[model samples]
Target: AQSVTQLDSQVPVFEEAPVELRCNYSSSVSVYLFWYVQYPNQGLQLLLKYLSGSTLVKGINGFEAEFNKSQTSFHLRKPSVHISDTAEYFCAVSDWGGGGADGLTFGKGTHLIIQP
Candidate 1:
């Protein structure tokens, strides 16, 4: 079974300040990773993903994350943040295709708080 751990439950940052959300996963077998952001009254949106190839993956809204196999970490970072960026971020890991029969594993999620 695979598991994800979000280092921080909440991250508070001023509007326009850079922020990073730490995510670490534990799995015995190979896996695909994903990062998703969910805003208030909205569904989860794909932020970035690491399937194969490059270790660093870029996504929409200037968000990016690097896949570190040795460290088993996929940290999400944004150079500059906005008030609209405040939301819940989730990290996921799946061993087989689309979670397989075991289902996908997910973290508790990290809530980003943007302050003015």
Candidate 2:
């Protein structure tokens, strides 16, 4: 079984400031890590993912994350943020070897509040 934990429930940042959302996971077997973002009243959009081969992965909208096997972490970061970036961020994990029988387990979610 795999589980994801988001340390921060809310992150407040000024426009154009840098921000990072912390995430950690635990799994008995190898797993895939993902970050998803959801705007107000919208469905989740894939921000980034770490499936294999790379420790650092970049995604849409200037977002990036590093997979740290040692720390069991996949924290998401943005060099600079905009007001449009205000949304709920989620960290998720899914079994790497499963046949999609079990869906992804997601963290509670971090509300990204961008202050103008």
User: Which candidate number maximizes lDDT?
Assistant: 2
Q: Which ranges of candidate 2 are over 4 A from the true structure?
A: 99-102
In model 2, what is the error at residue 53, expressed in angstroms? 0.9
| Model 1 residue pairs with clashes | none
- lDDT assessment of candidate 2: 0.95
For every model shown, what is its TM-score relative to the native structure? 0.93, 0.96
Write down the lDDT of every candidate, Cα atoms only: 0.92, 0.95
What are the per-residue Cα lDDT tens digits for candidate 2 across 2-98? 7889999999999999999999999998988999999989999999999999799999999999999999999999999999999999999988767
Report the number of backbone clashes for model 1: 0
